[model samples]
Target: MVNLIRNENMKLYRRWRTWIMAALMIGAVLIGSFVDWHYDNKDAGADDWKTQITQEKQHWKEMIADPKTEEGSKNYAKDQLAIGEYRLAHDIRPESDTMWSGINGSAQLIMLITLFTVIVAGDSLAGEFSTGTIKLLLIRPASRLKILLSKYISMILFGLLLLIVLFVVSLLTNGLLYHFKQLDLPLVSVDSAGNAIELSMLGNLWKSYMLNGVSTILFVTLAFMISSAFRSSAMAIGISIFALFAGAIIMELTQPYAWSKYMLFANLDLSQYLNGRPYQDGMTMTFSILVLAAYFILFNFVSWFFFTRRDVAA
Candidate 1:
């Protein structure tokens, strides 16, 4: 199994497209860090954070008090207001464009990581079949399940490598740009009960990456299943990419329906719970996890059934 996984990883890295994806991910982190530093570096040394918080509090208060404000907007404003007040009372400054802050902001780039992973995963099995390499793989002494597991594990390892690259590049890029200060800064957020709390900056960043990883794993699995079942890399990649971007829009459209909570797209974003908001009123982290687990099982089952039972010549 280890040798097979290694062989699969070698095949993946031998392609020019894989290196191109890594280069692009690094370039994005550099560009984003530079842009943020250019605009916000000056404020990193500002001493009037208390004044800034006061101003932000006033803005949030105004937003909350406005009669025309939507309920959601008002609730968000109230949460921010409470958090800002907590910061002032506790003498905690809001994160500026510091190293840690830039690292945290760069978490958004995980979407790019997901896209690249989906591309690799979508092509992993389908590319083999399309190129008539499946017969060679099947003739190997390894069982069909072992071969499939190896390919899937190799793809997941590649995704994790991209994630590590993103984190390391973002850290160095932002550290150089911002001089690596405020390593002990705390992240302030409001809990479900509107109470403000402080969390470790590093811990929060770790949590963000982990939660983002759930969606990445799901999308990669979905692409892999499509590739295995359909034997078409293009279709698998296209459909997975479409779902990645359109999931939020679909969730919004289906938010009014109670059954929408059970939809795969609706539950992909486990991070919503961390923000104290579920997609719908009754949806919780546990509910989303259960839905995602069921979908995960279904996708893998289809892939296994198709790959092991279907005729390669057909």
Candidate 2:
């Protein structure tokens, strides 16, 4: 099994499509960082959003600096002032690291990895026939199901590689472009995990990296399902992305449609799912887990059944 997976991985990785996808993933990350740096590097007056943050900050400071303000309001103003002072001294923007980490984590990773997964997974068995590679694959004394599973596992890992590349690209591009040497990420509020475990600067980056990796895995599963059905790599990528966009639009167009609550994309949004604000109530971590598990099982079964019965000749 180990050799089988390795062989599949190497073959998939060597394809022109594989490297092209990786290049695109890296490209996407750089593009995102550039867009981020464009605004973040600008002065506070350059954009409306920046102006808003600055204005609100000043307003709050005034509320506190006002001599007649209530004691509680004054105290609250002091806290904001301290935080604000920390920002001005450090020259950090509102988001700095946390915001980029999240944006790359979900949007960039999901779209890039999903596209790459569709190509790799869609071509898994179908490419065999498309490229006359099926004969070689079948001659290896392996069952069709085993070969399919091998590709499934390998492609899933490939999806994760997309996310890993995202991290590397963001670090390099954002680091140089923004001239940010290092960041101090505030981990625990001296509240969440007790005082014993304080999160360090490096630890924050690592945590964000790991979380983004997990999110990639979840999004890739859907690609696997779509790939299992379609013979064309293009179709698989299209269907996977279309499903994502469609789900989001469904939620917006028909709020009364309670079924929108169960859309995979709706559930894939772990943050919103955890928060439960934009959607209806009852969306918690446990609920997201259950939703993801249901999709995993259903998709796994669908892929297995379809691939097992698919016409290799077709």
Candidate 3:
């Protein structure tokens, strides 16, 4: 198992797409930081800078009425209460406009990463046949299932590495480039008028980070399965990314499909989960996230079963 895993790891490391993603993440952080630095120095004695958070919250709240969910109710109450508590707290807004827009672009890239993961890992078994490498692999003592698992595990690790690099880059750049010098920040929720719940700054960051990591893992598993079955890297990437955007559109087009919550792209935002924000009116973050977990299991089963049962005739 260890040797098989290492072999897969070597293959993943050699892939240039993996390195390009990491580079993009770091590059975005650096560029964003520079932009933030210029804005901070250029504007002085103006409170409009802090109004971004308030404006976004107000806009977001208007988009969904009550969300009518248990978690939504809780968040609403907490956010309202936060407005009361943080009245005399800080001079700045809870979050920045750049934070709202800038971070979203980076977040979108995660879905792209999921597609890449599927094309890379899912195709591991199928590719052997596509390229006639199955003959060489079968010459070994390892079971097909074991070999496939090694690729999946390596893909997961590669995803983790990409996220880690992104986190470190975001932390250093966001902290230094933006004037958010203090690591200790008050927790503010959008549910309330201004401030609802308050947590230490460090606590919030760690919580946000972990949720993002877990959600990414769930989305990648789906892509992996598609790749395994299709053996067409382009198709795997195309479908996964199309789903990332199209799933919501389809979900909206027909409300009768209650199973839309189970879609991979539907659960992409980890922050919403941590914030106790509802992805949909009927879905709790935990429940919606569990849907993702179930998909991961199903995909794994299909991939393993099909790969093991298929004839890799040379």
Candidate 4:
């Protein structure tokens, strides 16, 4: 199993697309950090912390009072108000455009990693079949299960490697662009009671990165299942990507229906729990986790069954 995994890893990393994806992630970090530094420098002396918070608080209050505001928007503003007030009370100034801020900001780019990984997952099995390499793989000593499992494991590791690279590069590039003076600073977050609590900067960043993993895992599993069930890499990749985006749109369109809460994409983003919000009123973190786990199991069952039972000669 170890040798099989190693072989799969080698095959994955040796591809030119793998290196190109890494370069794109590194380049994104550099470019985003540079832009952030430029803007932070411009705003550095524009207003004092207290003044900015005061204006922000006033804006939130106005948003709440506005009749045209949506329920979600008002709720979001209320959460922002809680955090903003906590920052003011604790003096956790606007994250100071530092390396740490860059690291936190880079969390947004996790979707890029997801996109790359989905393509890799969707292609892994189907591409082998498309190129007539699956026969060679099957003739090896390893069982079909081991080969498929090894490919899935390697794909996951590839995604993790990209994530680590993003964090490290963001830390280094932003450290060089700005400075690492705010290493001791703590992040302010709202607790369950809508009160602000201080959280370690590193702790918060890790949580943010892991929250992103929820979507990555779900969609990658979808791509993996699609790859195993189909012979065309293009079909697998295209359908998976479409579903990823379409899920969000469907959720938006079906917000009024109670059944929307049960949709796979609706529960994929666990980040909503971190901020004390769910897409719907009755949803919870535990519930979302259960839903995701159920789908994960279903996808894996279909992938394994179809991959093992079907004849490659077709």
Candidate 5:
């Protein structure tokens, strides 16, 4: 199994497209860091942050007090106000335009990582069949399940590698541009009870990345299932990418229905729970995790059934 996984990794990394994806991720980090540094308000004094917080608190208070505000908006404003007050009381200045801020911003690039992983997964099995390489793979001294597992594991490893590269590059680039000076900063957010809570900035960043990775795992599995079942890389890639972008829109549209809470797209974003705001009133982190686990199992089962049982004599 180890040798098979290694062989699959070699096949994956040897592709020119794979290297291009890595280069694109690195280039994006550099460009984004530079742009942020170029426009950062470096001359702002310590009091500037306090003033900004005061203004934000006033804004949130006004929003909460406005008669035209929706109930949800009022609740959101109250939460923000609570966080602002906590910051003021604790003198915990927000990490704005700092190295940690840039690193936190770089978490957005996980979407790109997901896209690349989906592309690889969409091709992993179907590409072999399309190129008449499935027969060679089957003739090897391994079970069909082992081969499929190896390919899937290799694709996951590839995605993880891209994530590591993104973090490292963002850290170095932003450190040089913004100076690694605020390493002890804390991120403040409101909990479910509308009370402020503080967490380590680095720890929060890592948690955000992992939470975002949940969606990536689901999408990659979805693409892999499509590829295995349909034997069409283009179809798999296209449908997966479409779902990645359109899922949020679909979730919003379906929000009126109670069953929408159980939809795959609705539960893909686990970060909502981190901020104490769920998609719906009853949805919780446990609910989302359970939903994702079901989908993950379903996708892998479908992929396994198709790859192992279907005739590949085309």
Candidate 6:
């Protein structure tokens, strides 16, 4: 099993496309940091922040008073108002213009890693069959299940590598752009009682990173399942990516319905819990994790069944 995984990893990294994806991931982070440095490097002292928050609160109040404003917009303003008030009470100036803030902001790019991982997982098995390489793989002494498992493991490891690359590149790029200050800053969040509490910086970052990583794994497994069941890599990749992006829109459109909470996308964003908010009122972190686990198991079962039972001819 060890040798099988090693061989699968070798095949994965030996491809030119693998390196290209890594390069693209690194390049995207660098470009993002450069743009942030060019546009958003203003220093905000306490008075500056107090003035800015006061202005924003006034603007939100005006928007709330307007009858023409949408409920959603008003709700967003209400949340911002609460946050602004919390900051004022806690004397927490907004996050400083520092590399740590940039690094934390760059966590939003995890979706890009999801996209690239989807492409890789979608092509992993189907591409082999399409190119008549499955026969060579099948003739090996290893069982079909082991080979399939190795491929899946390799695909996941590839995703992990991309995540590491993203973090490292963002750290380096932003560290140089904004000097390495704000390392001791705390991330503030609202509690259930509407009081602001401080969370450790590294704790919050890891929470964001791991939550996003779990989401990436779920979508990657979906693409892998499609790849195992279909012979065309293009179809698998297209359908998986479409489902990923469309899920968010669908969830938003159906949020009023109670059944929407059971949908896979509704539960995928565990980050909502970190902010003391869930997509649905009763939704909790444990519930979301359980839902995601069920979907993960289902995807893996379908992949295993199709890959091990299907006949491949070359």
- Name the runs in model 4 displaced over 4 angstroms: 58-82
RMSD of each: 2.0, 6.3, 5.3, 2.5, 1.8, 3.3
Question: Cα lDDT of all candidates, in order?
Answer: 0.89, 0.62, 0.61, 0.86, 0.90, 0.84
Candidate 2's C-alpha runs over 4 A off are 38-110, 178-180, 185-215, 230-234, 273-278
Candidate 1 vs. true structure, TM-score: 0.93
Per-residue lDDT of candidate 5, residues 46-137 (tens digit) = 56898998989999998988999999889889988898899999988887867777788888999999999999999988899899999999
Worst 10 residues of 5 by lDDT: 176-185
Which 10 residues in a row give candidate 4 its minimum summed lDDT? Answer: 41-50
Give the alpha carbon lDDT tens digit for every residue of 90-138 in model 2.
4544445334443443344555566567656766755666677776777
Best candidate, TM-score-wise? 5
Candidate 3, residues 31-68, lDDT tens digits: the string is 76566555643453346644554665565465445555
Model 1 CA RMSD to the hidden true structure, in angstroms: 2.0
Cand. 5 TM to true fold: 0.94
Q: What C-alpha lDDT does candidate 6 achieve relative to the native structure? A: 0.84
> Worst ten-residue run, lDDT, model 1?
41-50
Model 1 has a clash total of 0
TM-score, each model?
A: 0.93, 0.72, 0.75, 0.91, 0.94, 0.86
Q: Native-vs-model 1 lDDT?
A: 0.89
Alpha-carbon deviation at 36 in model 3, angstroms: 4.1
Report the CA-based lDDT of candidate 3 relative to the real structure: 0.61
Better of 3 and 4 by TM-score: 4
In candidate 1, position 247 carries an lDDT of 88
Q: Which regions of candidate 5 deviate over 4 angstroms?
A: 65-69
Would you list the rank order by TM-score, best first?
A: 5, 1, 4, 6, 3, 2
